[model samples]
Target: MKQLFVLATALLLAVSCSQNKAPKTLVLYYSQTNTTKAVAEEIANALGADLEAILPVVPYDGDMGATAARCAKDAAEGKLPELKPFTVDVAAYDVIFLGYPIWMGTYAPPVAAALEAVNLDGKKVVPFCTFGSGGLDTSVKDLQAKLPNTEILPGYGVRTARIDAAKAEVDYFLKSNGFLAGEVTPLPDFSEVRPATEADAAIFDAAVGTYPMIHAAATEVASRAVPGGIEYLFTAKDLPRDPAVEIPDHFIKVYVLAEDGKEPVFTQVLR
Candidate 1:
């Protein structure tokens, strides 16, 4: 009886401990406009994670032109602007979701500043980006190089102005990347390939200079071939190359619209 009682007590203690353990997640974002903030909130809500805002010591002007100027200046200087004081016990979370707007075609320097402030060694860093229309613009690659110690995954990017329409896209992106689970409705037939302007053509050419695959002929570029008539390519090369903007080698991605509606039937990295 005494032995049995001890065994039962041990089992009960193990069950209680298991039930009390919580999943660790953290959502951190830097937003000048609330678009990134809203998207970040949705992710945090979905993950039930702790939320932290990366604020600069000096706030940025929301005006597009002024903001562009400021971002350009910073990027040119490679300056790490001072950030408002904040803290995260990095060891506590197993995963961290980072969100930011694509400023000057790359991540806002303030995002880099926030990253510098924290140590992400051994942590999982998942990045989500918001842009006016330029999309991720090499922010993911840049972050990977910057935070070499962290185990980072491929990230999701959304147009800041169209985030409301991107809700399903956001949900699908997070899930496909393993941040969330369950049946994911793929992205819709959302891509529309339009005529490329001279500048657009030039950007594609420039991106190839940075990413050699961009200029490769369809046969030469070896990835899952996106079938014609089923794919859409959105090209934007009017991406300004100003010092204020931290634009990296921004390129385009091609995706096939899935029949299930809003789900990408296929996806490819163009550059």
Candidate 2:
């Protein structure tokens, strides 16, 4: 009976330990050149999360010319490309990492399709992108507009040329966003600030009109100085805008200025 009691206690301890383990994650990525796909796999393996591939219902051309043509047409028409069927039980995980390659200065259409098809109301979303030159291109901003009430963390982008070399950055990003099971690191506050000009306001207004969930706005109209440049104060609002100011090509860039008029505090390009 004593031996039986010892076994029961040991089993109980094991169960408790297992129950306290870090939550699992889900990695969803859409890649054309396989760079983003490779990164997604690495992150999933590192975090012990399930891997999901987001494919479009309409296939994309692997060649640059055809793909570019298709993407351009879609953008011009404001179309949300359809995605292959994907299902996720909202309660299965604590975090979802959405990965994609930057296409035409924004999130890939297939990724948008995937997000639209599924619901991510209460999940923490971490977006990672691979870009050739334009860097992150407004993926986080665009996502915030589309998905409201979701905790969409700031994204990380690696140059396509340096993708294989981005392991450290990828690890840091995952750790920073609370996706990987580890001690959480502090992040700089990234609240959206209002723009200074009517042009800026129009650009943000267009984005809000499109997504309408991020609560982005034009908060302050004044500018501040930082180390190298000026920081502009603005409110981030999520709402529709007048069609007159909705031109996509000429939206204002987002930036943070130093209070002392020394340099730019920080910056993110918004559309």
Candidate 3:
């Protein structure tokens, strides 16, 4: 009877331990315009994980041109904006979904600050970003460099214009990575995207040389018209010779606008 009682007590303890296991997943993000926040919320809901935002001590001005200028200044100085105290306990989560907006071809400064705050050693860090025209490869490499001790996964990137259509892509990303289990919603056919025309190529070619970091020679891959401007995806060669910075060899997204007979200006560049 004594031995049987001891065995039962051990079994109960094992069950209790299993039930008291800590949550292994969390979604952490910093968003300026709510684009990254929308995607992060979807991911958190799908994975049933906890959600936390990195609040900056000084919030960004909502104006795009102003924000871009500020980001450029900070990037050139290699300075990260100060972030408010993070709410999540870094030690409690084993998997971190790090999401942010791509600012000047990299993670926003607040994300840089957040990376410094957390000890992500031994954690699996998955990144996702919202960009105007930039891809995920550059930002993923940057994140890996910052969190050398963590396992960084190949991330997901969505154009800010396509956030409404991101449900299927987000679902597939989570399931393929083993973060979620279940049926994935099918994506709508985007076959209607118009191809780049000769005129579009000319416009892109004329604007590419005007930018500093962009190469003069470019091949227009795709073009689409948005509300106020035309968006061009270009494969650029011989990028600006900057040894101190890491630039990815990939398609750069450029937006051009010419209104009221004004000279067409390259409004945005996503490298």
lDDT of each: 0.67, 0.68, 0.75
Q: Candidate 3 residues 1-271, lDDT tens each? A: 9999999999999999999986489999999989999999999999889999999888996697999888888879988889888787977898889999987778988988988888899988889999876657788888878888899987887877668757877988888766777765443322243455677567666765454455644544555554344444554444546667766665555555443444554545555
For model 1, what is the error of residue 40's alpha carbon versus the real structure, in angstroms, after optimal superposition? 0.3
What's the lDDT for candidate 2?
Answer: 0.68
The TM-scores, one per candidate, come to: 0.65, 0.58, 0.65
For residues 1-271, could you state the per-residue lDDT of candidate 1 as single tens digits?
A: 9999999999999999989876589998999988889889988887778999998988996698988788778778888779878777756887888889887667888888888788888888888878754446478888889888888877877754357656776777778777678776443544344565554443334333343223321111112222222333534332444557755555455322233223332232423
- Residue by residue across 44-153, what tens digits does model 2's lDDT show? 88887888888777778668789988888887999977876766563577788889988877788898888777788888888888876434747788898998978987
What are the RMSDs of all candidates, in order?
8.4, 9.2, 8.7
lDDT order of candidates, top first: 3, 2, 1
Error of 2 at 33 (Å): 1.0
Separate clash counts for every candidate: 14, 24, 0
Clashing pairs in 3: none
Q: lDDT score, residue 246, model 3?
A: 66
The local lDDT score (0 to 100) that residue 192 gets in candidate 2 is 51
TM-score of 3: 0.65
Off by over 4 Å in 1: 1-22, 135-137, 185-271
